[model samples]
Target: MTRRPRVLPLEAPLHEAARIMRDEGIGDVLVTLGGRLCGLVTDRDIVIRGVAERRDAAHTTLGEVCSAALVTVGPDDDLGTAARLMRDQAVRRLPVVDAERRPVGIVSIGDLARVDGLGPGVLAGICQAPPNV
Candidate 1:
């Protein structure tokens, strides 16, 4: 797993985060503090909360819309488990954290796809064979 994902501080204005996301071609940012994972922000947050509320993105801090209920996984977690979490939660991104909840990296559907050689209807990695007795 790649370490130190591009992060945005919760104190940063929502607009700044949006700019970074667009510039980086990523849809989400890990909200971090002192190198620890705290929360997360996404483009959906920008549109659903910031624009819908008519809040000034330039002045609105990520703390306003960052989902503090962060669902995370460890770097050692298998990609399948992460996929299950995404499907169960209907979330597109997940913060890869250590046992102490410190941010190690970030994972997204894009990342997972990259892992499995995504192409022509490929889903994810086939890590194990079917059980046979």
Candidate 2:
């Protein structure tokens, strides 16, 4: 899991999110409201929901496009649980949160692939699974 996952306020602009992703070399950001995790905005969301829609990046807020139906895990959760959640949710990433729903870290498919025994096969299953549509 990537500790200290990047975060931004719900009111932050799309351009700001893009800049943070570019500067941090990350693909997504946890969106917060009153210091609690409320949503997630990925690079793909920025393109498909913001840019592709022809919205003004500087004016459009993350809350407007972020995926608000969050599926998260706690820091103590095991990799197997994380993998199952990701597969079931059709998500590539899961925010690791504290008791207060504050993000503490992030687990990604790449992170799972690094595990000794749970490697490519798990990833392949996730990748090969049909879309949640």
Worst 10 residues of 1 by lDDT: 124-133
Clashing pairs in 2: none
The local lDDT score (0 to 100) that residue 35 gets in candidate 1 is 63
Candidate 1: the clashing residue pairs are none
Q: Please estimate how well model 1 matches the true structure, expressed as its whole-model Cα lDDT.
A: 0.79
Candidate 1 residue lDDT tens string, 17-112: 888878766667888777678888888988998999999988899889888987789989998999899889987888899887788887777667
Q: What does candidate 2's lDDT look like per residue over 15-57, in tens digits?
A: 9999988876778999999999999999999999999999999
Regions of model 2 farther than 4 Å from truth: 118-133
- For model 1 the local lDDT of residue 7 reads 82
Off by over 4 Å in 1: 1-3, 117-133
